[model samples]
Target: MKILGKITILLCGSLLLFFTSDFPDFGDANSPASLHLSPYFIEHTLEDTAVPNVVTSVLADYRGYDTMFETTVILTAGLACFLLLRIPKRAVKNRYYLHEPTGVTLRFEGDKYPQESDVFKRIDSSWVPYDIIINFTCRLLIHFIQIFALYVVAHGHHSPGGGFQGGVVLGASVILFAISGNLRAAIKRFGEKTAALFSATGVFIYAGTAALCMVLGENFIDYAALAPILGSDRIMARSHGIFIVEIGVAVAVMAVMIWIYYNLSSAGKQDEGL
Candidate 1:
């Protein structure tokens, strides 16, 4: 029965592949995607939305619904990690004994030290001390990185960036914080509670802005209605709305990435034996 199931699954997959072989080739100018939606979006989006980047327009306005789903995916991932890898209030540590191929052994007690062996000592102790100057430079670069991430989010309308790219950059800045200092320090700066709250707040900001549009008697994402408050024309209102959502995405992504790093680094510590 198992063999039959495997064979059936393989046959079905092959049939699907066979059918897909006739689909339009990627990046072909004559393909339906290139000729139809792409051209229309390219020619009209700039005039209608006042954004120079076609991809940004597609993501933020032309297909804003899809962007909403993408944001939801981030939220779902954060929730799953929170549920699966949550650290318990009380956890124990395990002791490990290190043994070398050569017959040397070292035992660690109560998470105090790593198992030590002669071979391990050579490898671990051989690490040259990092230079203070280099560490200082890296610490300084983190500030610049955060500033650049904000620029990316803010300037997304006129260029090839948006919430997703900007969010990744912001998330990477926190990873630098983790690498430069200890994980505990990174968490202290951006704790699990703060990360979770930021993520929720980001989504709320996006949704609430759209809701406000609805209350003003426009469609859920009709940025034209927001033009009065934003102090801009309809097209500029769209640009402003996209910028706001991009900020939300950056916040959520940065928080989630930090949260994931924290959980993964602390996983072994969570399962220690008493």
Candidate 2:
């Protein structure tokens, strides 16, 4: 099976390479992609959208529906993972307790735990010795990571990063917490329910903004129509609308990434995940 898969991949790659010879060379200025819309987007994006980053203007404004549906795609993927892997609630039949200093194990049935036993703190089923260095490092880094992620999302109009890139960085901080500490602790901070809600909410924000433009008597996804609601001129309103949808994209991507990670790492049980 493995050899067959390898051969199949090789054949597909070879076919793709053969086809590529008919296309223009890398960065060919006369290429169809460069000649068609790329030049227009590069020259006029800032003038039309009032955003310094041409890429952001093109993605969040010029191609607003595309961005909105991409966010939907991420949310759908998260939902699909949840549906495929999430285990239904059931009674836990076994429990294990570890005596910290003494290094002893106590087993019990039917969700038994150490109550009033100060010597044995209630630990995750997959708990390991707490590494002070790792825990403290993650604790310190998480705040900075999240702050930078927000900056990246907000400043994409002037920089090289945007919603999808920033969202992935933000999600990594949560995964880092799980790795350095425990899955339960990470989930406690951002639970499955909250993640699911946020994932849907993000896509809603994007679609809702576009739909609102239509309600205001403009074409669908016509951000210029939002000028009255946002109390800005048409050009500025389009810029602001791009930022708003970028925020939505960021939120949806972040939640979806975390949701997928939780389901996959825990094998759908969401307990003692790596």
**lDDT of all predictions:** 0.73, 0.87
TM-score of each: 0.77, 0.86
lDDT of 1 by residue, 1-274 (tens): 9999999999999999999989988788899888899879978987888888888878877787777767778877888877887767345333333355654535444536553445543121222333577568769999899898888888888877777777888888887766665454566587778988988877777777777889888998776778989999998898788778778777777777766666676662322211
TM-score of 2: 0.86
Worst 10 residues of 1 by lDDT: 121-130
Considering every candidate listed, which one attains the maximal TM-score? 2
Over the full model, what C-alpha lDDT does candidate 1 score relative to the true structure?
0.73
Could you give candidate 2's per-residue lDDT for residues 1-274 as a string of tens digits? 9999999999999999999899998999999999988989988987898999998998988888788888989999999999999984344445567787898877767654566266875565666777999999999999999999999999999999889989999999999998898776788899999999999999998999899999999998889999998999999999998888888889999999999999998788786567
